[model samples]
Target: MNTKKHWAVVVGLGLLTLSACGSSGGASATGSKTVTLVSHDSWAVSKNVLADFEKQSGYKVHVLKDGDAGQAVNKAILTKDNPQGDVFFGVDNTLLSRALDNGLFQSYEAKGSDLVKPEFRVDQTKHRVTPIDSGDICVNYDKAYFSKHGLTPPQSFDDLVKPEYKNLLVTENAATSSPGLGFLLATAAQYGDGGTSRSSEAESGGGWQAYWTKLKANGVKVVDGWEQAYNQEFSGSAGGKKAKADRPLVVSYASSPPAEVIYADPKPTTAPTGTSYGTCFRQIEYAGLLSNARNTKGGKAFIDFLLTKEFQEDMPLNMYVYPVREGARVPAEFEKYGKQAPHPETMAPTKIAANRDQWVKSWTSLVLK
Candidate 1:
């Protein structure tokens, strides 16, 4: 939430809007070949990276910024029969099943798909989507606030519900936010939810759902989305510079600290915040060709470009995500201040796909009721 001025400048690129309705079946508005990428609003890359793609592929790239991850996916599904963009980017593993179930994407394995780490790969056999970059959702605490109050920062998910920590934590609602859903899955992984055999009934009074009940009782605050939870509620976020939030801890990314240092007004000598990785959730974002794309050849080329060293390396400072390509170099800021959770919690895409809706429903009933 406490984004640097430069980061604000990065997102200042106005959202691109296209008149065409389907992925590639018709000629472009200008009657030229083009690859239109429909992605969440958080997407950013230097102009040069895009220019390079255009130079090599000879197809103009048009990026249409939908809202958040959920909003983007919903739009894609709504436009499925006709299609709105050539490729869909930003569907993380948590929402991968939703896209797959709707038949929104066609398989196109990138040449570089094999370069990705095994853990980051979600759709292996089908190759419906290619892994691009990853981000982790974890609890971030205000160093100044914790130090001022002489309270030790929370180290684990279990620590957040302690009496001393009550009312000090804030997070987005799982039903409404990507980070929220990842956190929900993290809890499920940590506490166990009967491991695929047990039905939703087994989850109600035990495992992750039971943990949510405890968190609700402990006075944890929930917001509608990440911007509200991080910027308006978390004491350590950029909004705190002008108007501080009441809560000192918030659900945010491990890369947030590096972002803070990189974007600081006076350039902080050290990071002003720290992350709690005890139960962090790893979220791998992906790119895929739309099933109805008119330019299937162009879509394949664009998806392949996404997994290349050039595109993957541009991600760190520009978008603040780890490159799925193993040897890609990260910015010095990330090397110094970023926290890569050594043992982040993860679940299989199949299992997550099967249980996601039910898990979200049960979570809502327990925590938001």
Candidate 2:
């Protein structure tokens, strides 16, 4: 070969060698597909369930636990061009519109979307993502406090503002926390309506504004996150933690009841904590695939795993969220601590999506009083 041709041949051989080595390296190592699952903190499922997935699929499921759902989504969006995880979960209905708009999911229906709550099928893709579990953020009052103080549990969103309830409530900040936003949305849903068409009306009149003004006068307090509000403020059988000053009422999930019971050493036959009547707020959670995922197969598999009976039954005690499956088992503690509200109000996903950030921003300003 001429000198130029010899040089070209040598370069071609080097390229071929690199390609074969890369392919062989992938094939030889682990004999497994690594699926990265990015989810919010405290979203742990049953260990056996995940183990089963990793076992059956020959895919090692790597869970990348992040902070809040919003933060997780932000990270996913920033990496959308390159992509990181195979699936993303814990984007609730309140945050669904943003995830969808950002094109974070590739759609595929699960094996049993039919098993999901009928109302949850708002968007359908080949099962790109599916509903797993949900929780309600409600005013969790210490039964002991209310009874001892000779006060009644708060009945309406407006009731939190009453004189007797003064300075007892502590809640998450809506701007930073999912549960905080859930509480805010619950108030918006209960008094007015929260959908796309109507502007959220919170004037000095008879509504959320009026409710908040009363709560302010009643000595309502705000916290940076739910952990502070629950683990610190809410008095439960999980009672080793000291209550923060002026924090008798907390905003927490309904599933907290069961968790308090099961996790307590010497597992209480009955829940150690009691709930407020008609004081609960509802917040439905959701799961979705990343807009750009490297392993769509693993993404769908993970979601499918969540909806299974094993995962569903274990959810209440483990994660403190109600499984979307109609007949999932709930822990006794959850039944005790978590309340199925006498009259739970809900905001549609679309309405929540539209007004969420705006509502949070507005509430931060409004509640500064």
Candidate 3:
């Protein structure tokens, strides 16, 4: 999951107006002691934890938030020759191949590479990027809405297309949002690209495309990004509750439920939302030293700091993501309300790289039309 999807709502409405921490350009123009980090809008850290990194590395951190994950990665690629910053963060598994294929990053394995969980590691031969955090993209339901209507919240992909759930779902655009793309990939993984197998009542012989046809027919709604879908359309989020959003089901991160509990005004005894685990897709986010960074040393050091225990443990509360570091402790709210799915849908990066664009194009034509 991209933290950009939930950080604003999780932390406070004040975070919604967050801007670039410092001016643009590399360390050479600013100063040798300055390190610039280019990332999506969700980048966050506790002041003390970051102060520790600054003290240990002797580099003042400057942050530049480009936009959502897809927009940020595309912008970084366009500016790769004279990149906006020394390091780039917030690129995820969905867009990893595009970043690597564009030669956006240089090879530099961080200091604590061994501490990262093995499953999260990629580009093993090149060390082009370091895995930072991970989460699951899944469908979430408004518990109160379901209970009030005497309806059981959907538990699986098959359940989403049933008549009872019609016109009740909302999702982000697959071509624009990371979680939206992750959800698209989840269906692709569940129903093979062109396989004729009918795995369930919701599945068709035509594979994922046919599944989308059913989803679209069920009156699924599409929005441009996660914030709009979750905050303005889905009824489960605190923002949605205030907005009086009607859709009860939304494509969001599995960790969203805990955020609802942790950030509520009165702080509910239990999460107000729930995840449909069967629809989950594993998402991993990474950071790397820009190919022509002016502050290579500072960038590498910052990447190393990301894997430290202190930084890893601070991530859940700040960014609403699971650290890739093996021993990182998750917040109690996450443990009690938002456990990761036991069997999230997954696909190899190589497979995603080969098919992602075509799938998105086809999905756009099938569902968005």
List all candidate RMSDs to the true structure. Answer: 4.8, 13.3, 4.2
Candidate 2, residues 97-135: lDDT per residue as tens digits? 777777777777777678887865667645545887766
Give me the runs in candidate 1 sitting further than 4 Å from their true place: 1-32, 194-205
lDDT of 1 by residue, 1-369 (tens): 112332321111111233334444332442236888888777888789989999998998888776667777777877877777788898888878878998999988898888998878766789888989888888999999999999999988888878889899888888887788888999888777734412242334478867777788889998887777776888887775556688898888898888888877888988988999885988888889998787888889989999889998998877788998979989988888885798888888888988888998888888888
- lDDT for each candidate structure: 0.79, 0.63, 0.85
Could you give candidate 3's per-residue lDDT for residues 66-118 as a string of tens digits? Answer: 76677677777877887788999988887788889999999999999999999
Residue 229 in candidate 3, Cα distance off native in Å = 1.1
> Candidate 1: worst 10 consecutive residues by lDDT?
8-17
**Model 2, position 335: C-alpha lDDT score:** 58
Candidates 1 and 2 compared: the better one by TM-score is 1
Model 1: what TM-score?
0.89
Taking all chains together, the TM-score of candidate 2 against the true structure is: 0.82
* Candidate 2: stretches off by over 4 Å: 1-32, 125-128, 193-206, 235-246, 266-270, 336-339
TM-score of each: 0.89, 0.82, 0.93
lDDT of 1: 0.79
RMSD (CA, Å), candidate 3 to true, equals 4.2
